[model samples]
Each structure stands twice: as C-alpha cells, then as structure tokens.
Target: MRIVGISVLCLFCAFSAIVFFTYYRRNSATFSYDIVLPTIFGNSTEFNTSEIKKKRRAFVVNVFASWCTVCMQEHQTWKEISKRTPIDLYGIDYIDIEDNTLAWLQEPDNPYIAIAADYSGKAAKAFGLREYLKLLFSTKKVNWCSI
Candidate 1:
C-alpha cells in the first residue's frame, strides 16, 4: 500500500508539472532580455525600448527574410501601417543576405524605421519569436506588428 501511494503521488506530481509548464510556455513572455542587432548600414544598435515607451505606446519587431514569399505579401501592409500609425516599426532581417535585403527594400519603399540583421538566427531564438508572435497577435490591440 505504501509503495502504491508513493507511485500515485509521483504520477500526480508529474502531471501537475506538465500542466504548469504548458500554461507558462503558452502564456508567459519568453523573451525577457534587451535585443541589440547589427544594422544594414554596418552598425550595431539596440531596439529603442525606452523611446517606444516614452513616445509610442508600442512597437512592432518584424522578423523577415529577403526571400520569404509571405514577407513579400505582407510588405504593403507593413508600409501602410508605418505610414498611418503612431506605433514604431522595426525589422529584423532573419538569416538573409545583405545585398538581397537591400535590393528588396529599394523597390517597395522601405517601411521600417530601422532594420536589424540576424544572420545566424541567434537573435530570433533569444527572442522566442514564434511564441512572441502568438502573444502579440492575440492581444486586444488592433495594431499587431513585430519582427
């Protein structure tokens, strides 16, 4: 009976841990660090978190690649948002070639106020980008934007 009780308790603990982990993973902000990235213009810069807090209520960080079809599709939307909104827009060129990205930006009127280069995708991983996007989009704010 003692052994059975211990087994049951262990199982219950495992189940509880799984539930708690899932909830935290889904709901919590995974990236809790300042992000700095290399700029297309050959400079490294930090995301203006303080500026965004003071000036714009929010900012969008978009992770994009020059070769991404989905990114191309959404380019116009980003442009319009930048033009019309009070929110700040920033871009991360995720694992993209510099020349290709510059060329891509040239024709369509670059919408981003600043662009960051993430050649190795380390920045994207640090940001927990996939989960962050889910959280941002799920928010009540109509202006869902980010890299």
Candidate 2:
C-alpha cells in the first residue's frame, strides 16, 4: 500500500509538471532585459531599445524568418491586425540574410512599424525564446516613419 501511494503521487507530480511547463512556455511574452538590435537597412545603426518602449502603451515584437512558409502565411494575418489595431508592431528578422528579408518585406504591406536584425540570435536568447516565436508583447512608441 505504501509503494502504491508513492507511485500515484509521483505520477500526479509528473502530470502537473507537464501541464505547468506547457502553459509557461506558451504564455511567456515579455522580457525583463533590453534588446538592442541592428538595422538591416540604410545606415546599419542600432536603435534605442528602451526609448522606444516609453512612447507606446504596448507593442508586439514578431520573430520571423524570410524562408519560413508559416511566417509568410502569418504575414497576412499581421497585415490585417495592423489595419484594425493602433498597436505598433516590430519585426525581428531571425538569422536571415538581410537582402532576402528586404525583398520579403517589400512584397507584403509591411505591417512592422520598424524592423531590427538578430543576425546572431542574441536578442532572441534575451527574450527567452525556446522555439520559433510568433509574437512577444512589449511596450514602446516611436516615429517609425523616419526609421
């Protein structure tokens, strides 16, 4: 009876762990540290990571690769979202060739208010991304028209 009770408790713990981990992994949408990424276009400069956060009530940072088919399909959804919402969207081009990303963005309505490059994936690591991430909720405001 003692051995059976212990086994049941262990099984319950395992199940609970699985559920917790799955939820935590899926819902982690913010980061505590700053992520300064370089621009793939124009002057090759890094943008003010924290200052952008001060202006807007909230923003979304999307991780995408120029080569990912899912990202291409989801791009349309982002375009639609941009049309309906006032929230700004930023793009993190993940480990992709800069030229290819530039062309890719040109084909779309360009929903991102601005885009930053994560060539070495440091920004993605800072954001605690364990896998391909669609959206990461953040706060920021900027005159992206000038970027």
Candidate 3:
C-alpha cells in the first residue's frame, strides 16, 4: 500500500510539472519580426518591419493560409478595414502552395500592403502563431489581436 501511494504521488507531481511547463512555455512564447520569407506579392522578396513602420505609425501582421475557410471569409473585411486604417497591414501565408495564395489574394482587393509565403514554416514559428488567423498589432506595445 505504501509503495502504491508513493508511486501515485510521484506520478501526480510529474504530471503537474509537465502541465506547468507547457502553460509557461506557451504563454511566454514571444513573436519576433526577424522572419524573412519568399514574397508572394507586393513590396519585395523580404519583409522589413522597420520599413513598414516608417510608412505608417503602426502595422498589423496577419497570419493566414490559402486553404483556411475562415481566412477567406475575413478577406473582404480586411480589404474594407485596410481601406480605412492608416496602419499598414502585412500578411504571412502559412504553409500553403504559393500560387493558391496569390490567386486567393487576387480574388479580393488584397488588403495587405505586402504578403510573404511561408514555404519553410519558419515565419509561423517565429511569429509564435498558434492559429491560422492570428493578428499581431504593433503600436506602443505589441499585442495579439485575435479576430
């Protein structure tokens, strides 16, 4: 009985530690603008956040995919919003075929001032993007703007 109790306690502690660390790592993960991916359209082959900041006081980095149904649904909204906001909006196409991304963007007004294709998946990893539609708003402070 004593052995069983000790084993159970050890298991509980181990499980607790894993849960804590997972939570901590996910929450503490930071997004960086150092990502460089192939440009699908607009601007250039490189994504320079600083250059965008120079054009606008702030900017929005949206992570999207060509196959995402929700992303397609929101594309029009983005086009409308971009037409109104002074802030420059950029796009990172999450793992998808480059041609598909371009086609999808061409269907709409293409809200993004610049869009990049994340062929290597490094851009998504660098952005700490967990979802297909996560938006990072850079103003006085960087904030995760999920819509």
Candidate 4:
C-alpha cells in the first residue's frame, strides 16, 4: 500500500510538472516582428519590408488562407475598419494559390491593401498567427480609430 501511494504521488507530480512546463513555455514565448515576409503579388511592385514597417499608417497583418471560411467572413469587417481609419491593412495568405488569392482580392468585396502568399508558412509562424485567433474569440471591441 505504501509503495502504491508513493508511485501515485510521483506520477501526479510528473503530470503536473509537464502541464506547468507546457503552459509556461507557450505563454512565455514573446511575439516579435523581425521577420521579412515575402510578397506574392508585390514581387513586381516596389513595396519593401521597411516601407511596410515604417509607414505612419496603422497596419493590420492578417494571416489567413483562401480556404478559411473565417477569413472570408472577416472581409466585411476589415472593409469597414479600413474605411473608418487610416490603416494600411496587409494580408499573409497562409498556404494558398497565388491565382486564387489574386482572384479573391479582385472580387468587388476585397479589403486588403497588400496581399502576400505565404507558401512556406514561415511568415505566418513569424507573425504569431495562432495568437490572433484568440483576439477574434474575445468580446472586446478592437477600434483602430481610437488606436
């Protein structure tokens, strides 16, 4: 009975440690903007990384996929946001076809100022794309005009 209790206690401690470590590691990882994301459409255009970062206009780096229904749904909100504020909205199309991204943008309802195709997924990873989903989940209103 003593041996069983000790083993159970050890197991519990080990499990708790693992959970704590994972939670700490994920939360502790700071988000940075050192990444120079490549552009799919702006390749022929004159836009550069510094130009994007240094622009006085507020920028929203939206990482999305053409297949993602959420991205399509957010288009209207983005449009409204753009109109109400002096924002330079950029998009990183996470794993999408260039033609499709271009076609979708050409649709009368597009809102992005610049759209980049993240073919390798590196740019999305750099931008902490997953964390942005949490923003959408929250109830707080994100007002760019006030920012």
What RMSD does each model have against the real structure? 5.6, 6.7, 4.1, 6.0
Q: Write the per-residue lDDT of candidate 1 for residues 40-123, one digit (tens) a residue.
A: 842235554333344535667777887888888888998898889765667778888999999898875577877878898877
Which parts of model 1 are misplaced by more than 4 Å?
1-13, 16-30, 41-56, 131-147
The C-alpha TM-scores of every prediction are 0.66, 0.70, 0.73, 0.63
Model 2, residue 55: distance off in Å is 0.8
lDDT of 3 by residue, 1-147 (tens): 999999999999999999999997876676565556667788587876656655536778888888999988888888888999887788988889988887777764778888887877777777676667788777745433444
TM-score of 4: 0.63
* Cα-based lDDT at residue 96, candidate 1: 84
Report the lDDT tens digits of candidate 4 across residue range 1-147. 999999999999999999999987885485444456556654435324456655444567677776778877887888898788776667777888888877777767466766766688765565555633311111114322111
Winner by TM-score: 3
Q: How large an RMSD does model 4 have? A: 6.0
List pairs with backbone clashes in candidate 1. Answer: 61-146, 61-147, 62-146, 62-147, 63-147
Superposition TM-score, candidate 3 onto the true structure: 0.73
What is the per-residue lDDT of model 2 for residues 1-147, given as tens digits with 9 covering 90 to 100? Answer: 999999999999999999998888765555444677787743437644575677666777788899888998899999999899987777889889999999988874788877888889877777766677556675444322211
**Which consecutive 10 residues in model 4 have the weakest lDDT in total?**
134-143
Worst 10 residues of 2 by lDDT: 138-147
